[model samples]
Target: MRYSKFLLPTSKEAPSDADSTSMKYMYRAGMIRKVSAGLFYYLPYFNMILRKVNFRIRRGMEKLNSNEMKFPILVSQEILESSNRWNAFNKEMFKLKDRNDNGYAISPTNEEYATLVSNLFVKSYNDLPFSIYQIQQKHRDEIRPRNGVVRAREFTMKDAYSFHADEKDLHDYYKLMGEEYTKIFADLGIKTFPVLADSGAMGGNMCHEYMAISPEGEAEIGFCDACGYAANLEKVECKDIYSIDGTYKNKYDKIETPDAKTIAELMNMLQMEAKQFVKSMVYNADGNLVMVLVRGDRNVNEVKLANFLKATNLELATEKEIKSIGSVMGFVGPIGDLQNVRIIGDFEIKGMKNFVVGANEKNMHLRDVDACDIKCEWADMRFADENDVCPKCGAPLHVSQGNELGHIFALGKRYTEVMDSVFVGNDGKNHVPFMGCYGIGLERTVASIIDQHHDEKGLVLPMSVAPFKVDIIIVDTKKENQVKTAEELYNALEDAGVPVLLDDRSERAGVKFNDFELIGVPIRVTCGRSIENGKLEIVRRDNGETVEVEIANAKDFIINMIKNY
Candidate 1:
């Protein structure tokens, strides 16, 4: 394809609205254009790259015996209601009304649709362990869509669902899917770590997320370099706690700490480390008043708290609710006038012999209150930090940010049982099928690839997903010899089964070079004065390496270099 014939409108400056490096470069390289806050239009160049990547993913799926299928982008509300996702999804789901006034939703995921299809088609045990996949558009009403395509409201995704008979079959397919994910990421030339993740709202016991490390990522992962233990912070466990000496001479005393509410203010007045103080918060879990206690320095992991209480509904209690419970806003404690609120404390706080706590009255705080003096159920209810010890191993944890590209989950019988999707087992009994879901955010993968593979100039596309494998540039387009040589090389590369782009416009050498660099063609061949010498200059985008080869050997050299690179 000639550069002029294609919509390769390379720009030198990034759009003002582009927030991330990937978004900026994609806009500048003419890959995509923003239509709204979280919506974007994939231009021709972006579409071409997407097609190539999709083809590669499809090829990998075929090797795993996964059949490809297409499902509707919009699903009826009845389907989601039957699956119990209507209430489970809450506000994150985009719901609309059809012409007939029936409710419909843009699917955020396809687990329900896939399970419905399986129930209608698969009747016997012979169709038990089949996997189906599709690359289609998905929509979610994200609370805050930032970091370019990494957190978008509408994006393309490749979702695969596998149905199985038992735990053994599900585990086997899960392992196979993991291997396929490793291969796919390797083929895309990106380094990713498969880390354990919490199955949020998916109603599963086990899940894994493929995270690509980046400084701008939003998800926090706890990794232990020594023990090789990695997990998402939501599910990471810590076992270390601050030890309190029994011989310490600090005595329990009530002091006036008027209007000093937050931990920082209390710490300043007392001139002590945050570990020396205790923090308490109030929450409403399933319409029941609950109090949570933790160390002042630690943050509460709400997800873990919700799971601990086994409550589907939980939210931070409002100030008005706290006041109505006969407790001051800043002064709350476990020991007070008897109330019907449940008190849950962190295990670290319980282990402390003498800890500081609120006095439950205005202008007063209780210091050196021991855990044995208070009554509450305690557990590891706080967020894991760098100072915490790994639950699996004794090594210290390290925190890093990452963007989640793919997630594999063992859904167990959550959706199947709710939707009444059953299959006949070998015993001739009808049982709910164990389900697993695997998902890849196609646009986010593209964005992550750009995030991991770019420099100050622009995108450094991988050869497998580059819009064109080779870009043939006539450095002096007006020169007859250069033009003829460039055209001949372009045709030769195309005839040799290479995707080639010919830059045949009458542009300056610097402009052409910058355009080629911005567009990120993996390889470039320049025909200039070297044409008269029967030599061509080949430039590699990954590393600024250039080599001179004879015109007769340029095609083979370029092909071999691309394959090796």
Candidate 2:
């Protein structure tokens, strides 16, 4: 690629709306242009990066006997209906009506379509195990797009689905797919950690996500420092850290606590520790009023709460709703028979003896209250914080944030059973095949690579994914000897099977250097006044390491350097 002929629109400033390192660099490097919120137009340079990453994804999928296949961006309503995803996805889906009065959805995923496709081919027991993959566009109606392509509504993804004759076969193939995903990220020069994830609407009991560890990521993961037990924070669980002592005993009593609406205020008024209080929170769980009790210092994990209650939606109850249940604002308790309101207690709350709680009266509280006197269901409902013990090992858990690069789900029979996707068994009877799904977002992966491998100068793209391996900069294109030498080296490098970029533009040396660094071409060979020394300089983009090589051997030195990168 020649700089004079290519669409290399490098800039000094990135978009003002860019909030992350990759978002700023991609916009400044002219890799992608935003067309709307969560929508972008990929330019030539971005296309190059996309192709390289997609190639690695394809290579990894092929290792599992997966064949490449393409599905339509628009899936039919009937297909989604068969799998019940059309109703399950609900508002999250990009649904529209066609001119024929038929509804369709811009597929968020292809579980329905993949199951239908399998129904066509898997008619006999011989075709019991197989996998198919596609690199195509996926759409979702994102309410608020953030972090550029990381949360975009429309994007490209490599999605693969596998089918097996039984659950055992699915589990084996699932393990193999996990290994393949790890290798795929490694091949792209990106470090990732696979952690247990929740398959929310995908309707699977087992799923894991390959996370690119970073503070700028959108997801949080909790892992053990002593062992390899890691899980998404939304699904993570920890052992109870609070336990009851042997000696103390208490009887419930009411106390007057005036003008103390919050825990902090109540703590100061009564001069009691936060751990001595049992706080109650009211929520509208799918329109059913419920009160959740926990230790004062602990907070609730609403995701866990909703999952436990099997509720589609959960939120803090409004003041009007709270009063309608005969509970005063900021003074709700679990012991009252005021209404049919449900009460849920955290597991730690069960062991708490004679703790403080609201008296369900204006400016009042109850102290020395035992949890046995209250009627409620108990479960693990608090978020795991620092110093919390790990569920796998008894070690203290460590927490970190990461971006989800790839996710694989062990979808046992969600789609296969609903869509009637099955095969004839060897016993001459039909049996539903188990299913698995794996996905990697192309743009999100590219952005994560930049986020992981960039510096102040610009993106230090990996050799495998760089737009060009060697950037041959003809510093001072007016000099005949320098231009001629650069052209020769460019040709030599290209002929040696290197992706070379010839910067024969009439730009200044500083401008050329900055542009190439911003675009992050792997190796840069500058031919200028240095050519008078019978040598050219090879500068590494990642580390700024410069090596002087003879003009006759410049091509070989760069090729070797790139091979080592």
Candidate 3:
């Protein structure tokens, strides 16, 4: 491809809205244009990179014997309702009605459709352990789109679903899919690690997210180096490390603590430590009011709370909801006679003998409240942090931010059973096929590769995914020798099956150099005054390694480098 002919719109300044390195560089490199929030107009360069990544993914799927097919972008409401996800995904789904008043959604995922497809074809157990995949667009109405394509509302995804006869077979295939996902990311030159994750909304028995560590990431990861135990922060197991050793005292007294609504205020007023006070929090768990208690310094892990209560939606109760349950917004307590509300306490607070709690009234609190005085069920609901130790090896846990690249779930019968998708077993009995779901976000993965490989200059795109392997820049396009040498080398490299980009534009040498660097071609062969010495300079974009090669050998040199790349 010649730069003069192609739409390589390189720019000097990044977009003002670009927040991360990947977003900024991708915009300046002319790879993508922002159409709106969470939406983009992918340019030819971005499309080429996407194709390379998709090819790697397709190769992995082929290795797994997964058939590739296409499904409609719009999924009917009836099918979603059959799987009971119509209401569950309502917040994120882009819903619309057809002319006939029939509602549908721009499918966020195709679990229902995949199960229905399996039901249509799999008549017996012989078709039990097969997988099918599609590289198609997926849509979700993101509440806040950030970091460009990392959290886009509409983007491409490779979603694969596997069906098996039983739970064991499903688990086996799920493991294989996880391995394949690891290889696919590896092939794309993106480093990722799998961690246990919560199966939110998907309703799976188990799941793991492949995470790439980045500060701009949204997902929090808690990992241990000693035991090699890693999990999504929302799913980390907190051990019961709180136990009081002193003698118990039944001292529960109400006190007038004026204007101490928060734990910090209460601590300042009473001159007490954060661990000495218990916080009473009210949450709306799937429309049911529940009171949760934890130490003042601890934060509730909503994922664990939702999993414990088997609730689809869990959020903090509003002031009106709290008042409806006869609990004050800032003075909720486990000791109150809250009607129709379940009281749950964190396991760490079970051994507490004397602690401060809310008085269940405005500007008031209870001092020296004992554990026996509070009526609640105890469970582990506190978020794990740096102070926490690993549940497996007792080593100090490390916390970091990570972006989710791929996710594989052991879905079991969540969709098949609900959708009435079944197959005939060897015994001639109808059995619900167990399912496993695997997904890779094509754009997010591309951004992650940028995040992991870039430097101060620009993207250090890997050879496998770079838009062009070599960028042949003619420093002096007006000079006959420079232009002639560059054109010859570009044609030869192209003939040798190397993706080459020739900068034949009438731009300054510095401008040409900057553009190619920003574009991040693997190899850059400069045709300049050096051609007068029967030599051209070859520059590597990755490490900026420059070497002078004879014009006679430039084509073979670049081809060998790409062959080994």
Candidate 4:
């Protein structure tokens, strides 16, 4: 590739809307252009890198005995409905109507389509235990798609699904896929931690997510440095509540709290730790007013709460709804004039000796209330934070943010039973096949790579995914000797099976070098006046190290440097 013929738009000014390092560098390097809030256009330069990444992934997948296949981007709604994902997926799924008023959707995922394909072709157990993967576009209506490609409504994904006749086969394939994922990330030069994760709508028991640690990440993971136990915060478990030593005698009473609404206000007014106060909230779960109680210091993990209630729909009750229920916004509690609402309390609250709770009346609260007197169902309904002790090892949990690049789910019989994907055994008995899904967000992975490998200058692409392996720069393009020598060296590098970019533009040496660094071409060959003296300079983009080499040996030197990178 020649800079004179290519669109290498490099800018020193960062976009005002760029919030992350990857977004800023990608924009400055002209690798991607934002079309909408969560939509982007990948330029040719970035597309080249994407192609190389896809090649690596496909090569590894082939070695794992996985077949590459492409599925339709637009799928009929009937298939999704049959799999019970149409409603389960809800608004996050992009749906549309075709000319015949038939419902369709831009595939958010191809689990249903893959299952349908398997049902059409696969019959007996002999056809089982095969995996197919595809690199294709996926659409999800993210409520808040911020941080550029890290969370996007439209993006590329590498999704693979494996079918097996039995649980043993599924487990074996899952382990193999895990190993392959480790290798994939290793090949991309990223060290990732596979943490247990909640499958969410994917409907699986055992799931793991490949997380790349980054402060800009949205997902919160709870990690115990002492025990090395890590899990997504939504799934993190805490120890059982400490037993209370004594019983309380104070009767439930309402007192004026006076304009104290938030937990902080209540804590400040009462001058007590949040652990000593009860946080009561009203939730509308499937049109039922459910009173949820947690320690004031702890936040609610809505996923855990929803799963506990076994409710399909749950949301915080609106202020208006709360007012209609005969309770003020700030002073709501479980005890009040009798109502049909279900009251649920956190397990920790049950062990609390004497605590303060909302009075369910305006500007009032009940202090030193006994849990034995309070009547409610105890549940693990709150999020575990840094202060919480790990249920497994008793180590304090440390919270860190991470980006989910890949997720593997051990989906056992959920979809297969619903879709009637069955197999016959040697004993002639019909059995549902076990299923597993593994997914990698292709664009997010690229964004995460940039997030991890960039500096103030620009993107510092890992050598494995760089668009070009080497960039050849003529320090003085106006000098015919330098230009000729650079061109010859570039050709030689290309002949040596290295992807080389020739900076033949009329730009100054500083501009060319800056562009090369911004784009993160791993190796650079500088042909200047020194080249006329039978010497050339090789610069590494990652570290600003320049090595002088004889002009005759420049090709081998560049190739060797790239090999090491």
TM-score on alpha carbons, each prediction: 0.94, 0.92, 0.96, 0.96
Find the 10 residues in a row with the least total lDDT in model 1. 242-251
Instruction: For residue 147, give model 2's deviation from the true position in Å.
Output: 1.3
Q: Give the TM-score of candidate 2.
A: 0.92
Which candidate has the top score in lDDT?
A: 3
Whole-model alpha-carbon lDDT for candidate 1: 0.84
What shift in Å separates residue 101 of candidate 4 from its native position after superposition?
A: 2.2
> Cα RMSDs of all predictions?
2.5, 2.7, 1.9, 1.9
Quote model 3's TM-score. 0.96
lDDT of the structure predicted as candidate 4: 0.83
In model 4, the clashing pairs are none
**Ranking 1 against 4 by TM-score, winner:** 4
Clashing pairs in 1: none
Q: Report every candidate's CA lDDT.
A: 0.84, 0.87, 0.89, 0.83
Candidate 2, backbone clash total: 0
Better-scoring candidate (lDDT), 1 or 4 = 1
lDDT score for residue 117 of model 3:
92
lDDT per residue as tens, model 3, 416-497: 8888887889998989899999999999999999989887778889988987899998888789988888888888888988
Clash number by candidate, in order: 0, 0, 0, 0
Off by over 4 Å in 3: 243-250, 271-273, 351-354
